[model samples]
Target: MEKIFTLAELVEEYGTEVQKESFENNGNLNRRSFDSIIKRVEQDWESVKEEGRGSKRKIKCSGKLEDKAMKKDGRVRSGRQQVEHRIPMDVIVATHLEYDMTQQASMSLGKWAVEFGLITELEYDLLRSRHSSKLRQKHIDKAIQSGTLEEDQTKLLDEFTQHCLEIYGQLVKTLEHMEKCGIILFYENWMAYGKDGKVSINPEIMKKILKARRELMKKHEVVEFNLTAHRNAKKVKNFNREWKETLAEVKDENGNKLGIKYYWKEYAVILKASSKAVQRYLETYCVDSLEVYVNDKDLFINENVADYELKRKVNIMKKAEKRHKQKLQEYKEQKISFATAEDEEWIRFFYTQQELEDIVAGYDLGVKRLHLQNLYMERMGQLFELYNIKGYNNKKHLEGVS
Candidate 1:
């Protein structure tokens, strides 16, 4: 029997005053990153221990990742000292996984994962078991009970009883096609601890990831961050910063000319606003009417003014129309070219478009087929970016990846 060392045991055996400090700045074992990674590892180890299966990996020290322990006398103490180490503190242990026992452990975890709602059963079967099986009656009943799926669409999918049927079914073939075509299709899930705790990546999960994934995870094995600071950064990028400028004449109390007021405001807000916004703004300002200036002249003028003073909106409309067409053309060109290229790529990769469509059609076990399609699209999009970037943003997937 192979003996597995608890992290703390390893630390006590190998750590000295200088080992942790000496490896602190070393590229492979960054101290700060390791500090956080170890905290997560300990927590995961504890969770497994608490659930009674932690025997796969014993815990050297157990504590919540976020808080320090308070003694019975109410004094706080450091939880992680010397003997309680997390990986990247030691390179050899961090990257190691037991090959013989990992698969069974992973299947147990995968089943537990489904029971806890981390991933759908179909996803677990495809990713973990890869064996022929029938669609769980639970999923089918739930989909119907949810009522989002149309009866007709649900019926169409229901007819494909062999999709996951026990008799060497359609699912295996579909999955084979998906894998061969480099079409990334998998459910997203993580067994996360409390609000501030870490996501547990079981040895089983790691084995699969290591088997096929890039070197990033292995290279940075000890620095895994469950929550990234950059996850939502792009949402606010350039937000409300795009501005537009227009000129409007301001009249004096006596209706004399007041030179143009150069107005500037957010372009997106203005473009997206409905006509009702104009009335709302007028009410807020306690003004009876406000003239809109488009391009160089006033777009709205009362009959009290000269007919010639009423600037026709034709010029403004022309500009809007031109902009609309340009945007549409760009979208069309990019979309058509990308779709064609992707289709070709699928064929070249040995998975036909018809097979993909059939696979999707088989999975449409609900009325909300669009929602189901979106999940696949999102997964595929991630795969497209990842593989394409490895090829240095190859010309094929650039305009079409989105």
Candidate 2:
């Protein structure tokens, strides 16, 4: 069985070297010394324990094991009790003293260096405030002024700023994309808890509230329609004149003319119509308008702007031949060059030279069949026959093979 040393036992066995060093070196135990002692204890725990006891067995162990050992002893013996960490007050004081000494050394070094012209006052200040929030900015400024910080550190700081800018740009782009995608980003907080100590607007409660609102609107519309129909029940001889001359006309239960004020109901209908018209207009035009704006601003570019731009260029090329009759030959040449450049750029960024050459060759082979709708099918047939391959097929049949 593997022996398991408790934290206390490990500390006691390893800590002696650190304790002796602390006393000799003005009472200080550093992280490095502590780590070294811990490593040595892990390597030879039993040896350290024997050294601590002057080669005598200090740890008492129970002789009784399981059934056989207990039968032999005729009585049960308890297992060995583990040691506990019991630090003397002197050790704590020594630790504090060491910390204070180090702090004093750092302060003295910083002050002396600044005063003696070894380092600038600003550089000294920055070193003093190395653990502060303004550390990076102060370090960057000092590095820029003195040109003393390492190249990697300067590059890292510059990269950090670039990363922040990229993040901000992405956020703006994502928001614009969401708008174009018909997603309304609402920011609202409702009464979460009521004075009655009841949970008010939880997610479920909000869902119910929305349901109620829709139900209420539906009922309200039906009631308003009934009222309007009842009010318009009586016909006037001169309809336009009667409507223009009407003052306070009374309304029945369904708001029919019992001859006194139906204007309130008429006003309600006008308001409802206006509201519906606005909603309808937004539903029809808002999403497209937002998408156009997003595209115009190149907002989507932050996420896949390069890909989108490449696609856009390809689309322009496809339309060019039809749109530019007078410059047909020029458009064709431009399209071919654009395609070649795009392929080269993509290959350079993503592939090895040999792979790029293979891809370019494949594209060249496919170019002959470009005008065909099933161009891949035609090219694959030719490629397969040229290589004398079998069992493989063209695009349409390859779908089933996969």
- By TM-score, the best candidate is 1
Worst 10 residues of 1 by lDDT: 86-95
Residue 59, model 1, lDDT: 35
Cand. 1 TM to true fold = 0.18
Clashing pairs in 1: 133-164, 134-164, 149-366, 149-367, 150-367
Q: Candidate 2 at 203: error in angstroms? A: 27
Per-candidate total of colliding backbone pairs? 5, 8
Task: Give per-residue lDDT, candidate 2, residue 86.
Answer: 10
lDDT of 1 by residue, 25-118 (tens): 4423344533443444442232323111321334344432232111111111121111111111111111111111122222233343333222
Runs in model 2 deviating more than 4 A are: 1-136, 149-153, 157-402
Return the number of clashes found in candidate 1: 5
The alpha-carbon RMSD values of the candidates against the true structure, listed in the order shown, are: 32.9, 34.3
Q: Number of the top candidate by lDDT?
A: 2
| TM-score for all models, in order of appearance | 0.18, 0.14
lDDT of 2 by residue, 315-357 (tens): 3333333323423333234321226887768756877654554
lDDT of 1 at 247: 13
